[model samples]
Target: MIRGRITGSVVSTRKLINLVGSKFMEVEYLRGGVSESLIAVDLVGAGIGEEVLVVTGSSSLRALEKDAPADAVIVGIID
Candidate 1:
């Protein structure tokens, strides 16, 4: 899991069938003190500027409870 924060949202007019209803967010994570960003599917309801926990790889598919073309997903919102 990666610790990150939701910076913004992504709007797609077209996407894979499996990801049609998913909400995407731009997440910023710290890597060696350098900031990096990735687009993540939101499983939990997380808003901008919120701290979140993101899972990648197969874990992202599991979080969606189905097969998706997603490589990253927001699993939890940090307090």
Candidate 2:
């Protein structure tokens, strides 16, 4: 899992059939010294500016119920 902050969002009206009803967020990973950003599918209803826990690879696929062709997904939001 990667700890990150949701910095923004991605709105796509036209997506793959498998990704039709998913929400996308822009996250900046908060570990290490490097700041890396990625677009993540939001499985936990995380919003911009929230700290979130993200899962990647095959876990991302399961988190979103396989509706995700997503490589990264927000699995939890941290307070």
Each prediction's whole-model lDDT (CA)? 0.90, 0.85
Root-mean-square deviation per candidate: 1.0, 1.5
**Tens-digit lDDT string for candidate 2 (1-79):** 8999999988999778888888889999855798999889888878889999999887677666644477998888887
Q: 60, model 1: CA deviation in Å?
A: 1.0
Off by over 4 Å in 1: none
What's the TM-score of each model vs. the native? 0.92, 0.87
Residue 74, candidate 1: alpha-carbon lDDT: 92
| Model 2 clashing residue pairs (backbone) | none
Model 1, 1-79: lDDT tens digits are: 9999999999998877888888999999999999999999998889999999999887677667566788999999987
Alpha carbon lDDT at 34, candidate 2: 85
Score candidate 1 by lDDT. Answer: 0.90
